[model samples]
Structures are given as structure tokens and as C-alpha cells.
Target: MRNKKTPKIFLASFFLFSFLPLMVFADSQAESRKFFIDSSYDVANREQILATNKKVSSKAYFYVENDWFNKLEDEDKITVEQTLNSLAQEFDEVIYPRLTEAFGPEWRPGIDNDYRITVLFHQMKEGYQGYFNNGNEYLKIQNPISNEREMVYLNTDALFSKNINSYLAHEFVHLITFNQKERLRGVIEEVWLNEARADYAPTLLGYDDEFQDSNLQQRAKTFLSHQNDSLTEWLGEEKDYGVVNIFTHYLVDHYGLRILADSLKSSKVGIPSINESLKKAGFSEDFSQIFDNWLIAVYLEDCSLNEKYCYKSPNLKKLKISPSLIFLPSTLKTQFSLNYSTTFWAGNWYRIVGQEGKLEVKFEGVPDVQFKVIYVLCQNHQECSVDLMPLDNSQKGNLSLDDFGKEWTSLTLIPSLQGKVSGFDGRENYFPFSITASITRENQEQEIIAQLRAEIAQLKA
Candidate 1:
């Protein structure tokens, strides 16, 4: 879910002419009140309409579109009631405390002074779960388009599903972020990090403790399909959610939740905020180091080799990235070359396999772009060892190994862009690189000659 901002000049003009009337009518305790909703999702040709208050709790006021609520079946009404009750209780007992403690508090005693956040349910454009609009925090004189309250707008369809609570938890974090980062700090957080935090909300609330059909499980599947998705890019697609959700999970799993909390409380935003938190926590690793380790951890979730290379969560113990390209060398086809492109912080894995030969790999990347090339060698019945490939100033490196397919079962090359740490835009962000791997039978020939000499000696005997 994304929040939208309106231009300041238009808002100023609307407020000057209508401020007095809006303030006089704002205090009316009517059964229904006019609210402005995003028209992008609404099928109706209207953006302003009256929504009736259906239920009120200590912490929230649940409102539904007047027409939609009136037409609901009796059984559907009961389900909505049950869902709202569960949501209110969870928000009060769990979400409110945990997120507020981690991020910060949302605007208090909000606009109406009732201390209750508003939850509005209306028909939204399909595929949208929910969103939090910061415009609601302003008065009519400041933002004439404001809902003038702390509120989250959810799709009516969510009420009939099991994911209602999780959706609410996600948007609630946005509200907290508005106050913590934008309102108090006067800095807008990068969309990628903002969505990352919100996507991690369900897990933070323990809603994903169950692996089956849980948010974490679904995101894991999505990430596997698009494992190369740039972690810093926010395209507002499912792949974006996939990358951020799993990355944040791995982050909190290894570093603890303090990184997220401290980052939010810092004046810096995005990667800088994370780096600041890591420094304050007395850790030598920065954002780049953590991301580098994460690239390996996702590919090889083996804690036996190094604790930093795997996840502590049992649910993610079996998680690993499948190789993007698999190379099997034969006498007929002894060499392979591949040229591919990737975005910043995105990873590509190349696996090489051959028998009784020397494997030589040459890598050439864009000279100006920073790249980290890591080689993972897995031997038969032995633990895998990870090492970084040394690249020159021209961003070129080579690796030559003997006993390919004999002592080693597989070798995986992982290359990722490490140059850009901040200011990531998805447009034209692809970085291209080439990798050439060739297998030679020089070692095989020497072994064959030794065997032939031993046979000749046996015949003479």
C-alpha cells in the first residue's frame, strides 16, 4: 500500500474559502459523515460520500460505506462484527504495543480528540489490500483534502477473509511511520525501506508463526521466483514485496529488532539509517557487509560453516537460492560464456560442473561499477568453503582450479553490484557483466599417462 500527496497550492486555495463551514460542521455527531477516499480503486464515479459508523471501540472507530453496509447479508454482517472485534483486541493488546515500541507512537488524541484511530471499509480498486494516507493528520485550514483524523482505509473484501488482521497490522505501521519519520523527523523515508518495515509487520506481530499459508511462506515462494529482484527498488509490484519481506526477515533474524528500531529513531533514512544503527550497536559490519552476507546466506543456508551465512529461524533453515545458471562442461562443449545484467544489490549465481579437469573462470564487469564476486566450493562429504575473488581496478578477475568434478562436486559464482549504496531508482539501473568458464583436460591427461606407465610395468613383471 502507498500513500499519496496532493499539491500544496491547491490545498491552500480550497482551505481559504471553505475552512469556516467545514469547521462548524466537523463537530456534528451525525450517524454518517462525509469522507474523501482515493478514487483510483472505487468503481463508482464519486470520491466523496457518507460512511456510517458501524462500531466504536476504545482505540478505533469502524466505519463502512453507507450503501455497502446497508446491502450486506445478515451472515456477512455477523462476520464483519466478529472480524472487527478480533482486530480491535489484537490492535490494543499486541500490534499497538509492539510496533509503537519498535517504531514510535502515531499521532495522539488525533484530530477529533477521541484518541481513536478511524478504520474505513469501502470498495477499493481490485488487488489493493489497504493503505494509510497521511493527509488525515492535518486540519481543514492546512489541508482541505484531509480526512482530518488518524485513519486507515481498507478494502471491504478484506473483512470476509482471514487476512484482515494482517492487513490492518501492515497499515498501522505506516501510520506510526508517518509520525515517527515524516512528522517528527521532517524526512520522508525511502519507499523501499518504508514498505519493508510495513511488510515485516505481520511477522513482528507473530501472525506468521505458522509456516503453512502464512505471509512469510508466501513471500518466500515469491522471492524464489524473482530472486534477482533489486532490493532497493520499489516498483509497487509483488516482486518488490518478495524481496523486502524476506530481506527484512533475515535482517531481524540475524541482527535483532534493535537495528530496525534504532534506524527509525535516527535522523538518517534508508541505508544510511541502517548503517548508523550498525555503528551505534558497536558492529564492524555496515549495510554493504550485511547485504553481502545476506546474498550468501540466501544461497547457502548452512550455519555449520559460519553463523552469519544462515538464518536462525527454523522456518527459513531450508531456504536457499537456486542457481540462476548451471554449467555442465564436456569435451564437446568445454567452454561457456554468459553476459547478464542486474540492478544494484541484486545477486546472480552461476554453477559450474566438470570431471577430472581444471576449471578456469574469467569475469569482466562494467569498470566503473563496484562488484563483489564470491566463489563457493562444495567438496564431496566436506563442508562448503566460501571465499571472495580478488578483482583488479578494471573490475576483472579470474579463478583457476584443479580437480574439478573430483574433489569438488560443484562451484557457484555469486556476483552482485555493491557500488550504489543509496538513491536507488529503478529506471535504467541495470548493470551488465560477463562471465566465461572453460574446462581443460590437462590434469586428466597427466593422470591417464601415470596409469598407462603403471600398466606397462605390470606387463613387464
Candidate 2:
């Protein structure tokens, strides 16, 4: 074979281009480390930054990086100072007023205490928002990184008043909830409830940002389709924490923010505490029913129907439907399976049509795992009412429906991971499962009673 020698220029170009991505990858990876949530150097071990930098107080709070502040130009320094002061003002003016108005004066902290929010200005990752340690009493923020200026010389845009204020407002709620003057409970509140309240905090404080709106819409569109996913499994993630926000926002929208604050003060934990707050807010439905309704409202985002419950983004996108059920007679058990399985924070939405006959729906052959199934009277696609059940360790719930009548063309069934995820990382390739749904005649009693009542009325007439 003739020897075909490669050009020296081609060899050099190939070598350089091949490693270019790796070099870029390395730089990007290094940059990402800066924005870890609640960056590693918090008050618990801020000694490294504190060793040389004096803890200086801005008009609002204590910051441990005087050296970083001194490096700022005079104009930038004033902006930083005023921004910190504004955070304080937001807490006192916005956060406090909302809490007091929602709750009562008695629940408000009598006087500000030794603890104050501390600002940590560092280069956080691309999506790295600030983090809060109610345990540490600090609200850490990342110094914006821009090609226009160094991190220390970031301009007013880097200050991100709305963003920073929202962070402060949200974290401050967590701090206040943990260290409530009345001290209703010593233990930390449930994770979902805690974050739900935190998410609601920013909105009530008037610092509502696009982040919350966009995230809420995304989650609603994502989870509403799979209402059965575990609402409790948010560990080392951001969006799961945001799902809890919808719940709290719903509470505030219907009940008011006081219920959430009061939830912190009460010994009741998780759903029970939320239920108590709901009762206090004069809501008739308990958390379970409320959650069920929330599922339906999320799918059918019609504000006019009072189904308009969640903090939807302005666009009010529609919920994606999945795994529709096959209509079957109420005499035999019919199995309808999911066409495609979903992964973490994702789910399958189903619908089964029925006649006025009493309809019974059940799930079976389901693997022993944590998951949620929402049953809703979905006669019209636009009008839906949701019901939730957990099928765990070979558990399933049966539903009987004759009251909805034939107007209910179909029922919405959503089977999803309740987010009770364990054993595998969230990104496992999803596989379809043999989940069965069946319909059967409800007992004759419901109809018999109706006939009996009708007969008695007719006889009297």
C-alpha cells in the first residue's frame, strides 16, 4: 500500500481542536464550584475569610469581608452599603409588615436580637442563588461575575436589588420561623412546609421575582401531570423545594400567610400542621382534599372557575397528558398500562371514561415502591377535581363514583413517584411498569337509596 503521510498542519490542528473542548470543560467546571448552595465558608467555618477581614456592619447587617468591600471603588462601595441597608429595610418594612398583617402583633418578634444576616460575596456558579443557614444566621450571596468587571468591581447590576431582597426576605422567614420569639416548637419544621413558607415569603414581602414565577409554572406543568409523585422527597435539590412553594402559596392565597407562620409556631408537623393552619384559616377542606383539588386545578388552569389556585406564570401553560386509560365496562377488571415510564420529578397522567354506572377504579401488579395516584372526575378536560392515594409496598386505593354521572366522560389518573426516591440516583433510565386499573359496579345501595327516597316522595305527593 502506498504510504499517505498526513500534513504536519493537519496533525497540529487536530490535536489543538481535540483538547479545546477539554480545556473549556475544565474552565467551566472550575467556575461551577464557586456557586455551590450555601458555599462552604459560612459562619460555622468562616474563620478563613474572617482571619484577615474585619466584620464590618453596613446600615442593615454585619459582613465579614471588609477587605472585599475596601477593594470596591467608592461608587460601588456605596451601592453595596445601600443595598445591604435596603435588605434590612425590606425585612423590617416589607417582611415584617406582611407577617404582622397576616398573623397578629403577638406573633411578631418584640425586638431585633443579636443575630443579623451576613452577606458573603463570592463567585457563585451560573445558577447559584444565595443560600441561608437559619442555624448560622447568615444570608450568603455571590458576587456577580461579568467580563465587564472583576467580581470585586461588579456594578449596580451585580447588586440585583430585587434578587437580593427576595433572597433576604425568603431566608429571613426561615430564620424567624426557627427562632420565633414565642418559640412554638423547638424542632425544625417539615422540609416541604419549611421551604413552602420560604417560597411564599418573597412574594408576600413584595420582592417576588421571575425565578419563582417561572419555576412554579414549570413544576406545575411538570408535576401536575404526575400528581402522584412524592411531595416529601426534596433532598439536595432546588425544584422539589419549589413544589412545596405551590402548596404554601395556595395556603396564603386562600388562608393568608399567617397560617404558614403559625405552622412554624405549632407543634404539629408536616401535613397535620398545615391542616391545623387551614382550619384556622377557616378552610373547610383538610390538607388531603385540598391537595386533591390542587392537583385538578394545576391541570386545568382556569382562574374563572376558582380552579385558578396556583401562582401560574403569565402564559398559563397547559399540563401535558400521558398514558390515557381504555374505557371498559364496570363488570370486569381491565388493565391499562403506561406507554412510557417517567423518571424522578416526572410522571404519567391517565384518563378512563365511564357511563353513569357506579365506577370503581383500582391499581394492581404495581411494584412495591413509593408513588402517588391522583383520581379526578374529569368529565370535561377543562373542569377537573382531583383525589390522591399512595400505593406503597403493594398497596392500592379503590374509588367508587356514581355521583359524578355520565357528564364525566372520563376520569384522570396520574401515577407518579411520590418522590420517595431511594436506592438509585434520580437519573435512572425509566422503564415501563405493569400497573393495572379496573372498573366494577358499585353496590346497589346508592341506587336503592335514591329509588327509596324517590318512592317515598312520590307516595306523599
Best by TM-score: 1
Cα lDDT of model 1 by residue, 152-192, tens digit: 88888988877777888888888888778766676677778
lDDT, candidate 2, 1-461, per-residue tens: 00011122221222221121121111111121122223342323332342111223322232324445557789987776677566556656666557545533322211122222334454334443444433222111211211110011111233654466655445445545544422334344555555666666556655444645443454455444445444554443544654566555655665666677666667776667767877887778876555555555555555655644443534333443354566665433433543446544343556677544555666643464555677666656666565566555765566666654465767777655533322332234443444454443456467667878998999999
Show pairs that collide, candidate 1: 41-125
Candidate 1 local distance difference test against the native: 0.80
Q: What is the Å distance of residue 20 in model 2 from its true position?
A: 58
Number of colliding residue pairs in each model: 1, 8
Model 2: per-residue Cα lDDT at residue 374: 72
lDDT of 1 at 164: 76
Please give the distance, in angstroms, between residue 97's alpha carbon in candidate 2 and its true position after superposition. 4.2
Model 2 misplaced regions, further than 4 Å: 1-47, 51-59, 62-78, 100-126, 134-158, 181-184, 209-229, 302-336, 339-348, 351-362, 365-373, 377-411, 416-433, 436-461
Best by lDDT: 1
Tell me how candidate 2 scores on lDDT.
Answer: 0.48
- Locate the minimum summed-lDDT window of 10 residues in model 2: 146-155
TM-score of 2: 0.57
